[model samples]
Target: MKKLHLACLFLGTLILAAACKRDTDFNYYYYEPADFALLSQYLNLPDRPENYQSTLPKHLQSLGLAARPVDYDKATLGRVLFYDKNLSKDGTISCASCHKQELAFSDDKKVSAGVFGLTGDRNSIALGSVLSFSAYYGTDLFGPSGVPFFWDNRANTAAEQNLASMTNPNEMGMSHTDIVNAVQTQPYYEPLFRMAFGSNQVTQARVSEAIAEFVNGIGSYKSKFDSEAEKTLGYNTYSNLERNNFSGFSAAENRGKLIYLDNCASCHSPLQGRPEKMKANNGLDAATVDAGVGGVTNQANDMAQFKVPTLRNIELTGPYMHDGRFATLEEVVEHYSTGIQNHPNLSPELKYGYQPKKLNFSAQDKSDLVAFLKTLTDQELRTDKRYANPFK
Candidate 1:
């Protein structure tokens, strides 16, 4: 009897080992494109974006395009530039100082406290989904990518993205000359600068270029839904709650989707680009307020208009809004559901059949929407070695 029990135990162990082996085995060539038919009727884009006339709205169709390949050295230099403190006046703050990696590249403070411990007007936007801004690409003649970088769409490129932050007196507060001097004196940067720009001397332009590469690389597409959407990859540890959350919202959120399409799709893309373009201000407050893009242009019509950020990982990167006005996703939904203050320059899309300022979401409906948003979390990205801090 004892011998028989031992044999059974050994067989059970072998079976468990085999199961573990199957789960751990990875197949690389599993990914495939989504079916064209399903996306065509709802999202309304061509099967091949390269051949199709893009429906990206405004100048986005014209602006959005695939990024050209980058040099490995240049991209590496950009990573270094991102963490370097010489860019700031006091030589104390680096990009990572505010956009920490652990918090998914967002500062936890309601408003970013910068160089002199001065408070910023708005909360720091996370670095995720930043590189996905192809919709507003080529918007800037100088730094085409920078135009959409700031709270008010002020920066023109990722290279120029730090200009205001570094010199804002409240942020880095560093003068251009001071920054150049610091970089020039850094012994470790010489080879990196030389490799990136074919010279050891660091210049402002080189700094910008390197930083942009790193920022662009900060992008991601994998998430609970993204993986599930790709049947070839199969499923991993995603919970049933997350899946059920998506299905539950497939109805009500479908209504929200229609609402978003007629009203907000021109900017915050639900299905515009490869990953989906995002940007739009849904009349958050009364006119004459911050005036998001208008703040950059000083245009009256642009009042209260801010760039529509990605709903990707939207569940994580908040308090909410450029100003961090809403504390919870529910609050943001409620506000959009009802609280948009009427204004003269309000977005025309929000004019009729608008969701009231106090959206009347059922408890279940609100919970469902929140669950769908949580599926956007890319658990892998947070743990991936490529994007993780090298020091760790």
Candidate 2:
């Protein structure tokens, strides 16, 4: 009996020593309740403001997250919330009320209409492929960390971006508290909220987090242009017959290709993840009507500048430009062909100009150009199960 007791004591001491020494070596960062509380209050949620870790993937972390992942269910809920009209002040608006999915997340209106039929100053933009890129704020407001969102790169993170739209009088025009209340009161949301956040309790921060998650999940890639480029650039997807068509494509597409490469590529650049990201002026108006980046910078040089949207899925995300100003690819091509508003900030690539010196289309050229542009669409993204509205 004494031997049994001594042996038990010996094993207990050994186990205690291993727990203290070995377990201490492995450091697993975890979220404290206080962080969620702060986020719920909108106190410090740039996702990585103050280097806050995002639960994003390692590749995403290389893009820069401290070390936390965005909540997936929360993001999915945010998608439904985004398209939901009840959160608006007048119930006439939802996030999609301005940013339509058919138009690649943009509205057809030149300026978005808001509560009381108030029209906004700028055009709506498409919303997808959010995770592939980094945030940008002109003055390094994120401190050489990352670029923020918006035309001027204003909002620092997806959470903040969601909050801005909710409160903006010209947008949803709803209070954050009201949005939280609307979400929390729903029986459907409570189960989803609990599953996503470990608590059924809903709040503004979780709402923003979910919206950001949905935004991050929207990835648009594998366009037709991308396919062709991939084949040519050695990505290796085309058959020999498709490759044989390459010469004809080059002969036919080269003119349009040059226009795109020289002019459009600078901003829409190949794939969103590439290092040298693109943004553009596309010469809509040399004196951009809305004062794009200028609003954020107060700098004359940055006036009328908007982030260059991905040409991927261009066929679907139309009524083009920052104002939904051009409804068709031809109109957009022509703008670059000759309609440039000739301002100081206009990119120099246009100075050399189009092959015909204008994008005036013969029926064939227009058809070919459109075909080439259509290749930018990724059917998979449009049909992605992840991006579908959960409310339905």
Candidate 3:
């Protein structure tokens, strides 16, 4: 009996030591108890702003689009995956490596450096800079039309985009099988996968879906522009933009708004109105060096055309344009003001009689335009703990 009791005690000690080892292995990062709770607060939010429906123009009211919902548990898991550099082949890059939170989830580099020090061809597009991802890509913001991901509009869904980035040689540089192995090898992910999918089994599909859910949960609606827009109910039509002066804005900001409404809003869209055009050749280059959408579709009409991303948080997200060519907002405005090159596929809005149309913006016009653009900056999104890095 004495020998049996000693044997049992020895086995218990081994088990305890093994449990401690497992805990220490996963302790490289710490996730709080509160962080583990789904809360169901940040994710699963409405696609549009509260007053969005009430302020829609009569013509736009009949779209009959429903908001897409996000899963909180999945998003929580995604937050971990986004920051985990182990997802990369060399264990040096993650989704957050390219898309940083401080710069509105955009990289400040002209072209982001990926795993193995390879440089990407284009700028890192900002995520969650404008409306919620659901509204921006879902039925409402684009007016019942699905918005494709990436500058070239190659991927139709967020999952596809995430997978593409993971597999891209210049990005994560991980195969689907490699990605699965990486996640499975991590000691911390067992509980995360169980919490997210009710199973500890990790898969590429689940990883992409969870990351998309987390991304879709991110939003930037608490800006000065949103505040003023709410107070004024809404600015539904392009015609009324100049007529209404936001009570909260300074004269310079209001002046800039007029300039933006007249020149920029046709594509960017103020408030929540549908942009007149989604993709356009903004005359970045005279000749097709990159070919942009044309490269993806092999269609001549799509040449030099790129996704016209929303200008929200334009202050933080720079250098501007798909190639990150322009270093400052003034440079961007100057492009439209005097530097629009006559690309063959130039959008009609930028062309007058086929020659590059110059706005001839005065110094005051340029300054005010920058001022109005700054109003779109949302401090909440930049500092929100919910969307912050879960690993400490």
On lDDT, the leading prediction is 3
**Of 1 and 3, which scores higher on lDDT?**
3
Tens digit of per-residue lDDT, candidate 1, span 1-392 = 99999999999999998778464566342111233333232332222211111122221222343443445566566666667766676666778777766556777667777775667787787776433432233345424333367767776666677656766787878777776777777654665566567777767667767767656656445655454433322232222222232342356554444444444445555432332322345667665567677777888776666665666566667777888878888887777667777766655555565532344566766666666566656665566444444321
Error of 1 at 299 (Å): 1.6
Q: Which ten residues in a row have the lowest lDDT in candidate 2?
A: 44-53
Residue 227 displacement (Å), model 3: 0.5
Question: Which regions of candidate 1 deviate over 4 angstroms?
Answer: 1-65, 130-147, 230-267, 272-280, 353-359
In TM-score terms, candidate 2 sits at: 0.69
TM-score of each: 0.69, 0.69, 0.82
* Winner of 2 and 3 under TM-score: 3
RMSD of each: 16.2, 10.0, 10.9
Off by more than 4 A, model 2:
1-70, 129-147, 231-255, 271-280, 352-367
How many pairs of residues collide in each model? 16, 20, 0
| Top candidate (TM-score) | 3
Of 2 and 3, the candidate ahead on lDDT is: 3
Worst 10 residues of 1 by lDDT: 49-58
